[model samples]
Target: MKQDIHPDFKKVVFLDTSTGFKFLSGSTQGSDETIEWEDGNTYPLLKVEISSDSHPFYTGKQKLADAGGRIDKFKKKYNLD
Candidate 1:
């Protein structure tokens, strides 16, 4: 509850560079760059490498390793099958 000791928290725009997605949210992070949002207002712009839109896990496009095949190969190699 101290005054003048906390970082400024304000609405900022986070840009996902990979998917070109933009969202407005509150953040304490600062940026020199500014962007015009859909609301016709300029806000601080922060560029990010990945976001939910382009992430494999969120989009259900992640490739899971074939553990069953690996186990079979290991069993064959060790003659445990």
Candidate 2:
């Protein structure tokens, strides 16, 4: 509960660089850029490389490794089958 020692936390717009998705949220991060949101207000604009919209895991596009094959190979090599 100290005064004048904390960074300013305010509403900022995060833009996904890859998918061009934008969302408004509170953050302590500062930016030199600005953007007009859907609410007819301008907010600090922050660009990010990846977000939930374009992420592989979130979008169900992630490739799973073949762990079963690898395990079988290892067992065969060690003669533990």
Candidate 3:
């Protein structure tokens, strides 16, 4: 409720390079670059390496973390048959 003490929240675009996706949202995040949006206004453009679209969980392409058949190695070591 105070004036000049809060950050200006405005609509900005987040660009995901991995998936070439652009999203418009509001935030107080800072950026050094500006971009012209669809509304004929300029806002800070934030570039991110990953987002929901490119993430493994969202795309259902997650890779198992096991290295060199760790599950089989463990079973063999313990003689679990």
The number of the candidate with the highest TM-score is 2
Residue pairs in candidate 2 whose N, alpha carbon or C atoms collide under 3 angstroms: none
Cα lDDT tens digits, model 1, 1-81, are 879998889999999876678999999998999999999999999998778877898988863444338778988999997
Model number with the top lDDT: 2
TM-score for each prediction?
Answer: 0.70, 0.71, 0.61
Q: Which pairs of residues collide in candidate 3?
A: none
Residue 37 in candidate 2, Cα distance off native in Å: 0.4
lDDT per residue, candidate 3, 1-81, as tens digits? 778998889788998766678888999997889989888888899998777877797888963444457888999999986
Give the distance in Å from residue 4's predicted Cα in candidate 3 to where it truly belongs.
4.7
Better of 1 and 2 by lDDT: 2
Which ranking of candidates, highest lDDT first? 2, 1, 3
lDDT of 2 by residue, 1-81 (tens): 879998889999999876778999999998999999999999999998788887898998863344338768988999999
Error of 1 at 65 (Å): 20
